[model samples]
Target: MSSDAELLEASREDAGAFRELYERYALRVQGYHRRRTRSDDAAHDLTAETFAQAWLGRARFRDEAGGSAGPWLFGIARHVLLASVRRGQLERIACERLGLFDRLDCRPAAVEPQTAWLEDLDEDLDRALADLPAGQRDAIRLRVVDDLAYEQVAAALDTTPQAARVRVHRGLGALRTKLNHSTEASR
Candidate 1:
């Protein structure tokens, strides 16, 4: 169990030491990719590509510039994962335009209890959320889901904190109305 700095130093000299570094950081790299990309396979591929890039760029590795190799590797992985997601989005849009997914919506009826519960919740939430205006949805996602502060949300949305607060309030109000209506319908 060598310290990270020691491992990085050794890895700069020895290929075997680099392998040890990879083993140590691979899971973390994968986890970062998983969070960003939301796909295990994509994360695994991006993690592998990240290590490959790190290993190839070892000659350029500056201990001073990067406080930790782990963060450097993660940064590479994040860029790669984001690029992959953008490419995927483009491909999906192309496929949709070409009608590639038209037949896929016809296949259905695989239901597990947990999946069913999650699907129901997702549908309900989607409906509740659909009642919100786009501005309100953006505010809610930035503030609540992304856990950003009001100031941060305001900056991201290019609005004032008061405006962001208003949007979130309206979004929550809409959601509450939808939930009440749903409950009344159920009863």
Candidate 2:
């Protein structure tokens, strides 16, 4: 099996190698987007765009993080997701300016449980997350849940990269403490 680095190198000349890379990563990438977006259609589109961008930039691919191109691909995915959000914001502003806004109440519906353990974990995580301060919460979401780099998280939050790292570190520490407490209490 070709390493992700090897595949990326080959993909410079053979597009079929890129397909292999896509097959290896598409589902994982889609799942990452799905967890953050909570929308299947959006996840699909974001994953497609991530790969398309990856293919276009294959020549520039460098194995910055070991042998896997996972980090590079994810970096592209984050940018694609951010661009999509910016586009959505622009469209919303345009609609508001034109007085063409459709007032869709987009409340989150309850998730149906696939299993008891997963539900319990999710509930515990939600409780832990709710206990975090707003800045910490947002930082954790962007850095952990969305798998963005600290610099990217800083850019999104309009803070310094060190501040972003601090927020994520503190938030994760708090979450771990709370979750451990919760687990012990459960037992």
Candidate 3:
């Protein structure tokens, strides 16, 4: 069993090697997107797009996670999902501008009680994130949301790994405090 780094390197010559990498991570990557989008089809599409980007960009692969490519692949997944979301938002805005939003029978799926609760939790999370300082917020997003390694997070934030870790720790603490307060206040 070759490490992810070895698989990626081998993929440069034998594309089949990349299949091993996909088999290792495809489901996890799709699940990540699924949890974020709450849409199965979108998850599948985003997973495909993420893998396609990885395949095309294989040659440029940097072993940031020692023998693991989890962080790199996840980084791509995050970008793909963000792009998809941005496109969705822009389309909604365009529809609204053209008065098509109201005209369209865009009935959303009926939300289950559990889903409604989850949606509220998501809003609370967004609020907590908004309360963080910029550096801490970005660090937390890279480390927690994107699942990047400390090194990768540090690189993205142009800081040391120790600093990245500290920021994520502090940011998460703040979020927990805020959410706890919100929960208590709601009671």
Best by lDDT: 3
Clash list (residue pairs), candidate 2:
none
- The Cα RMSD in angstroms, rounded to one decimal, for candidate 2 relative to the true structure is 11.2
Report the Cα lDDT for residue 139, model 3: 94
TM-score of each: 0.43, 0.54, 0.54
**Model 3 spans with C-alpha error above 4 angstroms:** 95-187
Predicted candidate 3 versus true structure: per-residue lDDT over 1-187, tens digit per residue: 8999899999999988999999988987787666666777767888999999999999988664446777678668877766665656566667767777556443222321122212342576688889899999999889877979999999999999999888977776677567557645653
Better of 1 and 2 by lDDT: 2
lDDT of 1 by residue, 10-68 (tens): 77778888888888778766765554455676667778888888888776664421234
The superposed Cα distance between candidate 3 and the true structure at residue 129, in angstroms, equals 15
| Residues 1-187 of candidate 2: C-alpha lDDT, one tens digit per residue | 9988899999888988999999988977787667557668777888999999998899988553345776567668767777776656666667677766555532222321122212232565678889999999999889867979889999999999999988877776677567546545643
Model 3, position 151: C-alpha lDDT score: 100
Arranged by lDDT, best first? 3, 2, 1
lDDT of each: 0.65, 0.74, 0.75
lDDT assessment of candidate 1: 0.65
Any residue pairs clashing in model 1, and if so which? none
- In terms of TM-score, the best-performing candidate is 3
